[model samples]
Target chain A: MSADSPAGTHPDPTLTSLDIGHPVYAALLDPDTAFWALVDKTRVADTLAGGPLRDAYRQHADACRRELHALRFELKPSGVYLNPTERCNLNCRYCYLPESQRRSGGHMSVDQLLASLSRLRDYFRSIMPEGGRPRAIFHGAEPLMNRDAVFAAIDAFAGDFIFGLQTNGTLLDDGAVSFLTARNVSIGLSLDGPSAGITDATRHTWSSRSVHNRVLAAMNRLRGYGSWSVITTCTTENLPYLTAMVELFHAREVPTCMLNAVRCTLAGARDVKPDDGAMSRAFFAALDRTHELYRDGGRKLVVANFANILIAILAPTARRLMCDISPCGAGRAFFALAADGNLYPCSEFIGLPRFKGGHLLADGGIEAALTSDAFRSVIGRNVDAFSPCDQCVIRHFCGSPCPAEAHEMNGGMTSTGVFCAFYREQVNYALRLIADGKADDYLWDGWDDGTETLIDLAH
Target chain B: MTQTVLTKPQTQRASSPSPAVAPAIAVRKTCNPDGVGLSHYVLMDKKVAR
Candidate 1:
């Protein structure tokens, strides 16, 4: 990174990984790519390529590109979301999608769902970028509650797009797992943490008893089927138990874990505001502890989402990360078709009034909805409002604000996200970890990039 | 053109109002790429946002 580079200039995420543990001064002054690009002409190549550090350098470069466009996506086709049944067996207190609406029969018929999906498939085909596949996500009170409709829609739109769903793991029977696995559909289950006390505090059945056993059973079933992993929601109650959460995954031998701060959306849990300061402490502590446990226990790093982010920023060989960086991926790459045939930017606005664009059955169907002022305005506004974001150093790497969250939190596209504080906290923690003497031992040393201390930027 | 007469020397310099008044907003310096050890330095700002 050039020191005098302007504020808006995006830093190469790849350059970030050269050395994890070395002092920044060492990394900045490394022989090959010295801070001032100052070195004797004869020694540069040997410094970067002739040592065991070569591989680290390459990995750092790869990781940077992976993170540079983490949220970069080209709109394929607009997709539709069908809220088949507004019913969930588990009654999680912090349930983002409230059950009240569903219990009142906020369900769609099979015919209605299929029709909406067909319209979405046609729309995606019309505007798809060459060979890309349009995608759709099944989110609801519990998408699995209406299995018949889901299967029918999947079968109907098999070749048109990719399908994914988010569930709470109560109804993940063997048959359902087999069906989704056979279809190659990806699934994300909601589980807070290990044990009945932790998991049951929020997620529970109608009887108000612990659903931990059931959820664990479902996880075990999915693991046997070789498909799903748990998406843990980080909250104040569970912040202290992060190490426990990671250890649980290691115990279960789960492949991966994604930790998302508890969202306080309209449908989100009540009274749960993200404590950025505390969250940062918990996250760093957990990372350090987990790293040690992995080294000692010979267990795979199950919680690598943040580490992957670091890798994306620092390593050169990592794959590109995917996310809806900006206000949301609306008409450009994706759009959500509501259960009532209304189009939305995403499923986060299924019941919210602001995102409801137009009815597919009423107007000229999906075509008009795609071009509706409401729909276009939402997308246009999201893209146009790029002020605070444009000048940030981590612009490219940090994707834009989440549209749904923006709408829900700040009441507009331009509002700073509530999660901004948390992000700042995380960045600070990463910088501090680098400053402390532990950077070399825990991060940079022996992380071979192919040559002598490949990432020894301070060489 | 008439030359302006020199003004009398004042004991105190021209007084400017202090910046820290009203509903003071708390400001904290958390660790970033620079500065001291990673910890919060809390201080109240005189100029409030509201």
Candidate 2:
């Protein structure tokens, strides 16, 4: 088809732009061999499955329908993350939950938490069977600040749901450790780095040394029960210590570390992010250091973002990597149960004026989110709307641009992020790392025939 | 027996069968077609035979 014809607007015509020839357009019909060469069939399938090709072609159309069905998880909102109190002990500059949203001293009572979670339990009951229960995350000013409310909700939903908590480690003491272990709760701590210089600058409590000392002590105490890992942010303050950070985690024997760039928010924390170039350099440096440590046969450290892209290259089926799809896990595949018993799409987009669908306590939550016009508008618009992303060759493998970042930076889901340069740099670095034989060991060398085709190409 | 109980709730939430609505903009990008090459992009909004 000619470029003038809109992609996915019309059905497959008698001939395509890929078409070799048609008498009416004899000259135009000649195949664009150069273009055809660039089209990787595997990449095309990945893109089409999640792209405009969902509507353009008909052969795998049924499969496309199933993909849509599975992707749109029309289940009850199983998890609730309450910002029980909005005032955090450690005011992380990059905190997405703005101070305006914090409840501060106004803690959510046990009854309030129970009301929200009971609605959650009922919703899950309506969606999932007994054994295939739901899960929830505890968040807020700090889940630790309102530890009793957190446990009460956990206890209320005990047999029917799993509980996980995200806390800035300042308050993670021995008692907190004991409580989590006794209840089999998973914990994710926000610890940016191994050194005081890096971690203290971003996550330190009032005492400057409080966060570092407490986090280390907490890590030691919780080393035995349930899972605990660090959630790191690459801020300007922490960028210089990338290697030190990874080495610290390696030394601590922490199994995993999720490395994320400092996301700018409306929370009035502009200074929190490092200069773009510096941040990108630091991230790449961290990736390089981790590879070095791996060669030395140290504890495994995973940079989650790269791990995801590597998985796409190396393994497609290892649980659809989260960020590969749209960001802001809205009505698509995820649901978040908020403290107010309101069911929002995902936690990140929780406070957005445009995002809240309806309350779970009122009726079934899935229908409200699924049928809402705003939510549908997002789901209906695929990778077709933006620039760079719309034309990206790696669009299929990269998934689409994160909708939240796109919304924040571009003013709409249909637009590309203004600062997409950062992501582009990361992708380029990853490609270089993989091609340089650094990521060779991670690539699968043993899949046969059918699997070999996928694995070999990734390597 | 428990599996049946679990999946039952899923069955009740039947598909609403809403009609699909097309997006306002093109979802996929294609290459230029002067019979010349695939290397060039026209950035045109419409599709046509090369």
Candidate 3:
């Protein structure tokens, strides 16, 4: 079939050979005609089938393939989520951490910490062509529970690596703030919202103490310290307060906020997981409010959802991180180093044996574990191989089929999760923004006035 | 400036005229998964919106 052929016409042999499905074919068949011009199928096929444009397309495809492979092998981790201790002060209802693991007080010894950092440094230096500077992110049931280990790791690797900490914020005392600020360690505080009624409902201490005042006080104290970001996990309980959450962050002058949909996991409590439709509505509603704040309210609250959409739409080629890519970056660009010296592909795989790569002390250590068949299997699973997502027009842009979410929702790695609809809506919203010439409105930073130009809205 | 709440349905608008320079092919860079330093990747020159 030719490019001009109507729907249901015999499939283009070239596209059929390339395994291009109907949805992608329909996107290409758009009346814009520029789609074909950009793809230059005749050129691509001729190049593939041995013709004049062969070398150029071959070279481009080869480069993309090589980069993809390197992402799995050579690219050093941009950040490592180090679970310094499994101990947490709060028992969040929506937390996915297994109860057993949460009770255990396992902490990484200084020796173990040194060994892990050494392994990461060697791996990063060997694979990174431009000398990768990986950051050490301290995560936990509560990282602050083992503050000494965190400080030790920071002191040990301070000059060589950047440091970040994710905490409940209630434990962030004045001394903690001083230490973190002195070392320039960025902190991400887990806060549901500003109201004690909303935040204390789920995020409370083990003794059932209300943590709202403590957390808010910490937020106030850390305002001028290094960098501060808020991570709010959206559950049905806090769904009604989503807008309020953004407003609170803006009011605090928080630089960045990540509103994450709580992943439904078998190992965690059965708190309500919002349906795709509900999440889509809540996400867009929050996004609209955030945009209003930035464009009119003069608040610099940068919601990661809107920022990610903008990046996906405006700089598709520049998205090198796994979280934004097809196969999901789980094992490729990011990994989770458990406290017990075991390595997992992502944070969600901490307690799960099936996803364990190996130990940090293995002969080849991180490198051997990452290149192992187990890790490769996780990284190799791409959106192109998964259903629905395989035919998605926004597959290249929307970070879908997250390996951890897939396992949590579908009990497997290759399946798309409940968030597919929400992701599709987000991409659609981003496309609309580009088409409306309001792409600049999505710019949070990094560009001077009038520097960014919207080239085209592809989808 | 008053904050205008977005209540209208978000629909695809007509495509604008293409830029004189076609979008450049971006080789993905290693980025922080948390998006802390992502602004550095934002293009200052011509950029594709698609």
Candidate with the greatest lDDT versus the true structure: 3
lDDT of 3 by residue, A4-111 (tens): 222342322221122222111111211111111122222334333544222333333333333333432344455677888877888888776776777766777777
- Please state what fraction of the native interface contacts candidate 2 reproduces: 0.00
Error of 2 at A156 (Å): 2.8
Better of 2 and 3 by DockQ: 3
Off by over 4 Å in 3: A1-76, A267-270, A447-459, B1-50
Question: What DockQ results for candidate 2?
Answer: 0.01
Of 1 and 3, the candidate ahead on DockQ is: 3
Q: Candidate 3 at residue B24, lDDT?
A: 13
Encode model 1's per-residue lDDT on A1-459: one tens digit a residue: 221222353433222222222222112122112111111223344544444334344445433333222223223333445566767766666665556665554567788888777766666667665675655667667888888898888888888767766677778888887788788675667777677788776667877877777777777776643334567777777788877887777677655566766655564553555477877677767777767876788655444345333332333122112231342445444566655567765565665765677886775866666677767655554332356754443433234445556667677766655566566455444433444323222332222222121233322
- In model 1, which regions exceed 4 Å deviation? A1-22, A25-81, A129-131, A224-226, A267-270, A297-299, A302-308, A311-324, A361-367, A370-373, A376-391, A428-459, B1-50
Alpha-carbon lDDT of model 3: 0.60
Rank by lDDT, highest first: 3, 1, 2
For every model in order, the fraction of real contacts preserved is: 0.00, 0.00, 0.00
Q: What order do you get sorting by DockQ, best first?
A: 3, 2, 1
lDDT of 3 at A342: 83
State the lDDT of candidate 3 residue by residue for B1-50, as single tens digits.
12222222223323569422222111122222232222111111111111
What is the Å distance of residue A290 in model 3 from its true position? Answer: 1.5
lDDT of 2 by residue, B1-50 (tens): 00100000110223459632211111111111111100000001011111
